[model samples]
Structures are given as C-alpha cells and as structure tokens.
Target: MSSAPVVVVATFTAKPESVDTVRDACKTAIEAVHQEPGCDLYALHEADGTFVFVEQWADQDALKVHGTAPAVGALFGAIGDHLAAPPDIKFLQRVVAGDPAKGQLRA
Candidate 1:
C-alpha cells in the first residue's frame, strides 16, 4: 500500500452575524497553514454562513505545525465567540481518484 498523510476536512456553521468574521478568520488560518513546510493544500469555502476547511498535509508533523501556528491561534481566539457550535472535523484516506464515473482503488 502507498503511504501518504491523511486529509483533514472540517465544516463549521457560523452565526448569521458572524459569518463574515468567521470567513476572514478562516482565510487567515488557511494562509498560515499554506506556508507551512509540508502543507499540500489549505483552502476554505463558505456558503450561507457555513464554512468548510479542506487541508492536505505531508504528514502528521506538518499537521501538528499547522495546529500550533500563531495565525491559527489568532483565528481561534477571534472566532470562538462567533461560532454556533464547535467545528466538525474529519480525517480521511483517499480510496479512489481519477474519475467519479469509474471506480478506482487506492493501494
């Protein structure tokens, strides 16, 4: 089996009044994560006050660096009061790629 770091996906629902604030905070966090040495991808998406974070790292160490970054800390500090609930985070390993119409296996 090929060895690769797992992907992290997170979804956050923000209070209506705090949507913009959350989006800004997430953007800052993404930027910080993107600059990390082993970060593959760090992106944030928003829709109707819902925010999603999609991150890919080279390994656990890289993810740890992101978790402790000052920008992430700042974002957490700023958005804590604005969230309706804690963010939902998921870790996944790719099982398929290429085309959705055709099944593929990871190995």
Candidate 2:
C-alpha cells in the first residue's frame, strides 16, 4: 500500500436519549484505538448531540487494518441503534501551503 498518511473525519449524531450511551462506547473504542499500530491520532469531540472523530494514520495499509479492527466492531455493536443515522465518514487529502506546520495535522 502507499505510504501516504491518511486522515479521516467521522460524524455521528446521537438520538436525544442515547447520547451518553454513544459517548461511552466511543470512549471505550478510542482507548483501544490509541494503542493500535500506526495510529497517530484518534480524538473525539461533541457539540449539541453530534459526535465527531478526527483521526490520522500512518498510511493506507494501516487505515485499512483499522477499519476491521476489533475496536471498530465493538464500537459499532455498542452504538449501532443509538445513532441517528449511518456515520458520515470522510477521507481527506491535504493540500500543502504556507506555514506547513499550521496547515496540516501533526502525525
């Protein structure tokens, strides 16, 4: 696989009553993801009732592996019904510009 780093943003909207449940599941998965090979960043954020995950990986191969990791499976199983809809996942490509450090995600 290519060695280019991968960036992903996944958004999940929780049902009003299932907010805590979804958050808990995501936190559990984040802990496991942090220990995975090639994981650079796996952070969670929330606003209103929407949860967002911003992730960075070493390369395409690593990202592919992460997609099928046990943590991912557990995360889905735990929060599947709690989500308002299917996750909104986006894979991104960086465009280099001035101030390289400020322009792109570290790691």
Worst-scoring 10-residue span by lDDT in model 1: 98-107
In the predicted model 2, the residue pairs found to clash are: none
lDDT of 1 by residue, 2-101 (tens): 3376588888899989998998888877766777777887778888899988778777877777788888789889898999999888987767667856
Give one digit per residue, the lDDT tens place, for model 2 in 63-100: 99999999999999999999999999999999999998
Residue 102 shift from truth in candidate 1, angstroms:
9.1
| Superposed Cα RMSD, model 1 | 3.8
Score residue 99 of candidate 1 by CA lDDT. Answer: 88
> Using lDDT as the measure, which candidate wins?
2
**lDDT, candidate 1, residue 53?**
82
